[model samples]
Target: MKATNEIKPRLDVVSRAITSIVEGVCKENDFDIQYSGIESTDGLPVRQLPAIWDALKTAKARMNHQMNQLISRITHRWNLASSIHRLPAEVLAIIFQEFEPIPGHPDGDSSLLNLLLVLRAWYDAITGSPQLWRSFGAHTPYNIARLVVDHSKALPISVDWRPPREPPKRDLGKVLDLAIENSARVKSLTASVPHEGDPHL
Candidate 1:
């Protein structure tokens, strides 16, 4: 029973590895999968066209080649192979800090936070590091204000508000007020007001 249990786990691992390799190759090569049905000569449906069938054959061959190469490399480097997931939390945090976070990223900074929250070691390592949070900036929307407050780090703040081409009943004061309200830490403000051949500072 013990031997069988161990063998089962190994088989499961191998199966997952094979599946991953196959899928990875397919994705890299932009392979598409299709299903087909055999048909009779008597005006019955025939197998899928050359496009779908040929793509499947090519994809399978490519997948097998990739998996074989991966296996060879793993066997050659087995002694030095170490799972990335098992790396020291601090090292992983430093590695992750290399990726910049886009303001509208679907996962947001929450994605990195979730990764750090995976274990106590990661939490301590990530939370103790400040570089990971440096990417929180103006382009991140209103969430940046919260992040700055949480960090208690003063950032060089700049606000640029372009006023209308024609001055209305009210002047740039309203626009400046809005900028202040939104970005209280703003150290420098630049704005464009109506020219009308007149310049005011």
Candidate 2:
């Protein structure tokens, strides 16, 4: 038998074959199939119903899997032929840097974090670029700050620390201390200390 991949049927032929199969099944069972439901209220054999249901479920799963595979292959091929992928690592890194969130912007880390999830190539390009990780926001956690510092590769980093309205569980002093330890590398700093009336200052 020929492999399934080797068989290429025309779209019309495939459609007709499917239609014929449905028509034949309906004709043999003395059933009239409709879009919503069967026309006749006649019931199928109880024993055969389970088998048919299971077969339909299995076929549906198989079709879904095959469709997913086809889509993935097409996406992979499209990416391969894309000009973005052809860019040099330096150029790609610059592009990724452009996606970095602006200082003091809410949800600062989200954009870069999402970029990391796009593709392996994009992840590699962003991760391998140290300059892109130089900016740190006030809400940035210790671990994330550490990661950015480590990746900054001795380059100067920008720090933005805005006092929150509510006091945080973690010691803000310690967080500042961590950033202070790397203060020599600090290029741009923006910090707001809470005041007596304004906790959000």
In candidate 1, stretches whose alpha carbon ends up further than 4 angstroms from where it belongs are: 1-86, 98-100, 103-110, 137-145, 148-201
Q: Which sections of candidate 2 miss by over 4 Å?
A: 1-46, 105-110, 141-143, 164-177
> TM-score for all predictions?
0.31, 0.68
Each candidate: what lDDT? 0.49, 0.70
Give the least accurate 10-residue stretch of model 2, judged by summed lDDT.
33-42
lDDT score for residue 37 of model 2: 32
lDDT by residue (tens digit), candidate 1, 15-88: 66655544444445455322121231123223534444455578779879987999878755652354754687
lDDT of 2 by residue, 54-162 (tens): 5556666776898899989988888877888888879998888877755563556458878887777888888888978887666766676777888889888898887
Candidate 1 achieves a global lDDT of 0.49
lDDT of 2 at 54: 59
Please give the TM-score that candidate 1 achieves against the real structure.
Answer: 0.31
Model 1: pairs clashing at backbone N, Cα or C within 3 Å: none
Task: State each model's C-alpha RMSD to the native.
Answer: 14.4, 7.1
